[model samples]
Target: MGNDGQSVGDRRGGLAYYELEFADDGAVARDTGLRAAVTAGQVDDVFVFCHGWNNGADSARRLYTTMVDLLADGLARHTPDKGARTAVTGVFWPSLLFPEDDPTTGRPASAPRPTGGELAAGLEPAFPGNKDNLARIGVLLDDKGGSDRLAEFHERAKKLLTTPNLDAGEDSGERAAAELPTETVITYYSGWSRVDGQAAPGLADPVEGLWEGAREVLRTLSYYEMKNRAGQVGRGGLGPFLSTLATPDGCRPREHLLGHSFGARLVAYALSGLADGLVDGASPVKSLFLIQGAFSHFSFNDVLPFDPGRGGALSCYRNRVDGPLLSTFSAHDRAAGWWYPLASMLKRQDASSQADLLYRWGAMGADGYQVDTASRVRLAEEGFPYGFTTGGFYRLDANSVISTLQSPFSGAHSDICHPEVAWAAMAAADLAGEHQRPAR
Candidate 1:
C-alpha cells in the first residue's frame, strides 16, 4: 500500500474478497470462500467493491480495507442504534497497470503521475515493464507509415468488437485479446496519428517534460482494458458469487456496490449482467455508490442512445434499487472530466463536436444525466458529501469539496476517501435499507 488515502482506525471487520482466477478463455476458474460462506449462511450485509484502473491486488485490498473501515465508522455515526454490520468483498480482476518501458537508459522510466502531496497517493509503483511495451508500440506506429495506421486500428478494433455481436458469430476469449493491446492502441491514437482535438494543456513533451503522455497512454490502456474486462466478468464470473449472495434465505444481508473510476464502470456492467435477478426483485444489491466515476453520466439514462441497444449497463439497475442509485461527482476531478470522454471519443471517432462529443465524453462528476426529473433533488446545503436521497437517481455534487474546498490544483482524481464522503455513503445505504424493511 504505497499511498493510502488517509490513515484510519484498524476496524476492518469481516473484510473478504473472492480472489479469482480467470481461465485463458476468461471463465471464472476458482472462487475461494465466497460461495462456501454464502452456502453456509455466514454472510450478512455484503458490500461488493470493485477498484478502478492502475491498481494491483495489494493496492485494491488496502483501499477496500480502508474504505470499509471508514464506512463502518460512518454507519455508527448515522445509525448507532441499528448496529448492522456489512461484509466487504473486493473483486480483483486482471486489470492492466500501464507500465511504460523507456528506451534511453534501457530501463523503465517512471511514468509521470499527479503528485499533489498525500491526496493523490495510489498503489502504482515505479515499474520498468510498461515502458518497454510502450516503446515497442511507438516503434510499430512509426513503422506503420502514416495516419492510415489509425484507420487500421479502427477497423481492427471495430471488427473484434462487432464480429460477435453485429455479425452473429461465436465471440471467444481469444477474440477479445486478438485486438491490439490497449497500450498499443493508445500510442497510435494519441501519439502521432490523431487529426482532431489536441491533448489537454500540459508539459509540451510527455517524455522530455512530465509523464503526462505516459499517464495519458496508461489511462487510455487501463480504461479500455477495465471496461472490456468488467463486461466479461460480470457476464460469466460473478454467477457463483452473486447467486449465493442473492439467495432467498431471508437472513441474507442487503448488498451495496461501490466502484471508483473504471471500477464504477465495472459495477455498472456487473449490474447489467445481473439485471435478470434484479428485475425480479431477487438481487442482492440494495444501492450503488459511484464516487468520482470515470464513466459516462448517460450510462443509466433511459433517454440516451445506448451502445448495446438494450440500454446502458445501469439501465436495468434503475428499476431494482431500493433507495437511489447514488453517485458522488466532483467537478474538480480533472482526470474524469478530461480523460474519460476524451479517450472514449478518440476510440470511436465516428462523431464530430456537434454530433455528440459531450455525450461521448460523459463524466458523472462533470455533467449529471438529463433523463429523469426524479433525479432533480434539491442540492445539499452542506459541503463535501452532500446528500440527496431522491429514492431514484441521486447525484451528490461534491464540486466544493474537490475544487475550492479540499483538493489542490492538479485535481483530485483518486483522492476520494474523506470522512464526510464516507458518512454520505453510509447515509445513503441506511436510507436504502429503510426502504427494504417493513413500513415503520
Candidate 2:
C-alpha cells in the first residue's frame, strides 16, 4: 500500500503511462515523476484516471492500462497525428474490498459471518482509534447478543462514522437514521434484504441472527467512511497536485479527468480544490468523465428536487469544468442500483412508492445526473455521432454496452474496460481540445 506511487515499468501498449499515488489523507507521495514527464512537453494531452473501491495497486494498474490501451488504439486509427502526444496517469489510493455474494443465491458462497476477531481485524485499518469499540463489537458478535447489544453496536459504529461539528442537513436519510431506534434500523435492513432476495425463506427470525445484522451495520458505516475519505483525498491531494501542474502564465497540457465508482466522487471533489482563479483560465483539466459513479445522482444539482432549499455538495462547482462533464449510468450496475441506495437511505418516511425512495437516494451510476442542466445520450461505438459540445453536462445511457452480469454484488459495475467506453472519453477530450483556449 505504501508503494502506491511506484511505476510498474511495463506499458502494455505503446502508450506512455505513469502512476500517481495519494495517501488516505489526500497527501501526494513525493517524486512520482508524473509531473516531470508531463511538463517535459512531450505530452500534449493527459488522461488522469482514478479507480473505485476494492482495487489494490495491481488491479488499478490493470484497469488504467486496459482503458489507456483502448484509447491509444482509437487515437492511432482515427487521429494518428496525436497518438504520440498523449499520456496516462493512474491514481492509486487505499480502498477496502467488501465480501462478494453469489449471484444465483444472493448469499456468500462460504461462511455467512466471519469470526468476531476476523471482522475486527478486517475493519481496523478503515476505522483507526476505534479499537475499543471494535473489540466490543467483536465480543457482541461472538456472543450473538440481543437488542441491547445491537443498540450499543449502532452507537459505537455511528461514533466511528460520523464527523463532529459538520453540517448534517444535506442527507435527510442519514440524519433520520441517526435519530432512529435500533429496532427500526434492523427492520429496514430486513426489508432491504428481502427486496434484494437475500432473505431466504424459513431462516431463523431476523432478530435471532443479530450478529449477521451487526456485520451489515459495520459495512454500512464503512461505506460512509470511504465516501468521506474519497472526497478528502480528492480535495486535499489530487486537486492541489493538479493545480501545481500549470504555471499561472505558462501553457499546459490539455488534461482530462476520469474516475470510476467512488473514484468518481474523488475526482469531482477535486474540482472544489482548484485555485479559485484557475477554474476559468489556467485550469489544467479540460473535461471530466464519471464511469459507473457510486455517489448521488443529484451531486451537481443546484436545487435538489426533494428539498427546495438545499443543493448538492458540488452544485456550485459545475462551472469549474471548463469543458464537458459526462457520466455513464446503467440499469445493470446493481452496486449503484441496489446496495448504494439501500445502504445510503437508513430510513424513509414518505407514503409514496418504493421507486420514489430509490430515486431520492439513487446513485449516479444507476440513475445518471438528475440536474436539469444535464442532457441524456446513448453510449455508442467508436465512430458514432455524439455531437457533444463544451460546457455541457451529459448523462450517457450505457445500459446496452455495460449490461454484462459480472457479479451478483457488483453487477456490471466493473465492466467498463471496453473499447466503446474509452472512445467516449477520447471523444470528450477531442471536443475540449477543439475549443481549447489559445496558449498564453
RMSD of candidates 1 onward, in order: 8.7, 3.9
Q: What lDDT does model 2 reach?
A: 0.73
The lDDT of model 1 is 0.50
lDDT of 1 at 123: 14
Instruction: Estimate, for each residue in 93-199, the C-alpha lDDT of model 2 and write its tens digit.
Output: 76765433323324444545456766766677666788888888778767767778888877876776643211123433444444678777655554545323466
Expressed as tens digits, the lDDT of each residue in 373-427 for candidate 1 is 4353323421234343434566666665555422221156666666656655665
Candidate 1 has which clashing residue pairs, if any? 99-130, 99-131, 100-130, 100-131, 101-130, 101-131, 101-132, 341-361
Candidate of highest lDDT: 2
Off by over 4 Å in 1: 1-26, 29-32, 80-84, 100-222, 246-251, 275-277, 305-313, 347-356, 374-391, 403-410, 431-440
The lDDT per prediction is: 0.50, 0.73
Q: After superposition, how far is residue 99 of candidate 2 from its true place, in Å?
A: 3.4
